[model samples]
Target: MDSITFRSDTVLSDVHMYTPNIRHLMVRLNAVGQPVFVSKFRILRNINVCSKDDIGDLGNEENRELVGVNNASTSRVDCSNTMANEKKDEEKKETAATEILLDDDGDLDVPRRPSDFVNSCEKDLWREKVYPTIISKGEEVPFEEYDEDWSICNDIRIEHTMDTTLEDVGKQIWRGAFLLADYILNNTYLFRGSTVLELGAGTGLTSIVMATVAKTIFCTDVGEDLMNMCERNIIVNKHIYGAAGGEIKVRELDWLRDDLCTDTKNPYCWSEEEIAHLYDYTNVLLAADVFYDDDLTDAFFQTMYRILSNLKNRSITYLSVEKRLNFTLRKMDVTCDAYDHFRLCLADLESINDGKTKFIVEAIKLTFPQFLFYERVEQLELWKIIAEPLISNTQQ
Candidate 1:
């Protein structure tokens, strides 16, 4: 055979790195030679309360009041007027808070400490620090007024790719992951102490976020390169969710394959014990933005059915997808073919009359609070699937 040489760095040229904030983290390469960069997502505890001015002082009493402190002793008429003013001011403050929470370029503003929330007297002390002068003296000036002991809470760091081809898109982050992560953060009680399985986890961002509340997480995907990257993300973000006693295991799960990988040579293969635990203890399933391809969508449902049928208990799945409109040559107009096909598959799944399993599908309302920062486009949607095995199927 003729000599055939492959360049390892060629993939690096096609790879792009992304980080939401300005701070830089260490970068490393995956098994496939793609450069992986860490992206930090600052989690918001309360969307309605957080503002640019009250960032790190989430529960601080001194800066907690929405309305200004008013006279304690007042007449009934004055009290009524004050109530109206407070209501109006509260609305305006909430709006402003939402607006200034993120900067123009969508970067989270630098976190501020409780001490940084200063009064008029302390403003002059840090005036020069906030606005540095280009024409400074030879000696370096120290910033004593501003608190340097600031720390961010619930910060989730994910290893992901910035730009790549559609085939390697799973290495990049998507809005669906953010939406799912937000839902988990908003309603942690539902997933608390639950054994969760995340399908097509990609960079494993949503899985990491779920680990904060879920007791156990099986973050599954295909390919060695992607699996390695996902495992690395779980390691970097362990500090955020590990304290809660949550555990995450990364494994290779190919939707195209009929059986789980059991080969000992495969590093990402599942153990016999893990496979048993998955079918016995898993109570929840999750998938984010994995419905773009028709063939993959079909395989995903097959895998879903196989896993759900094998589960010992009824399990619920939360799937998030972003509808992308494209001008197709066949349609010759704006259409979401991939999304339409996904809906068809879902309908087929629900319409199944198989004596073994029952699938119920429902559209989840998007009214839930958003805890993660992202452009939750109108096309983004969340669907809930409840898979219950019949008595006969369970007995088998």
Candidate 2:
């Protein structure tokens, strides 16, 4: 046999040495007559080494007489023991390396399993840092804010800032949008291969989620800055949607601007072609936290009516609002009577069609503590409305 010393330092130190229950050894042999480069051998077992020495006679007189010679012998024994331990360690390291190599090469027939403790630790880490930091934040902050920390299935993205201003109020994503998106994802099959339009899409969280599920999503907010931010968020998560074969566009859509829906002179305005395209592809309309201001209620409903009327196919409109008592009271206190204005608009629409269009509203109560209460305390109402071509044939 040709002899070769496999250096213990090169292979043994890099392998896992503390793994219990099994031991592995690798041997490489070279034959003078063999035509091949090398031959490899592997051995695996469950074995341990132990010392067998008697120590009960340490206090005997005969032992005392032999103590001097015993002491010298003790030193030699200690040296030998140390050498033996070093040799064993080297051997173990080599064995570990061999096991790893064999496993990598698919030559090791042992089934490797992950330790349960490691998996549990990973789960605990995700629950502790990922859930509270990313998933639990309310709707006012768009879902895009958590893009970097979490993976979104669609192309939708969000950008957020700490800046709070009246003009930028429409930029904030409400928690209700998250709930709406979750509901749609879990219960409805309305998103696939569809073009979706999200009105008053604050941080565009719902749009982001919808973008993941829809063929295309158009996320709109009222302000220029908010629209820019929405676009920025979309760019940030562009890759995510690309991978999923979906797309998202963030644009400014002012419900108060009548020109937005009709002006042909302005490029940013909703042109006739765009309107036709919207009517053709859009099957679902989503809105969240849009009913807070009583002043915009009429214009909001009119816009919704026009959009719904144009769709050739039946469209499902999901509108969520936090029913604020303060707003109702404020409108009542004011001479304008905002609720009355809204009711009058609804009544007018109802009178024209004899309630041909269908509206279903359900109130959802949200839980929050008083001290941490930043969002207005209000009951959320989700409305599912079906638009009818003619008001006369609509069901009440």
lDDT of each: 0.68, 0.45
lDDT of 2 by residue, 262-303 (tens): 544433356566666676778788887666456677778877
TM-score each candidate.
Answer: 0.71, 0.50
List candidate 1 stretches off by more than 4 Å: 1-26, 46-152, 392-394
How many pairs collide in each candidate, listed in order? 0, 16
Q: In model 2, which runs have C-alpha deviations exceeding 4 angstroms?
A: 1-157, 261-273, 327-378, 390-396
By TM-score, who's the top model here? Answer: 1
Count steric clashes of candidate 1. 0
lDDT of 1 at 11: 23
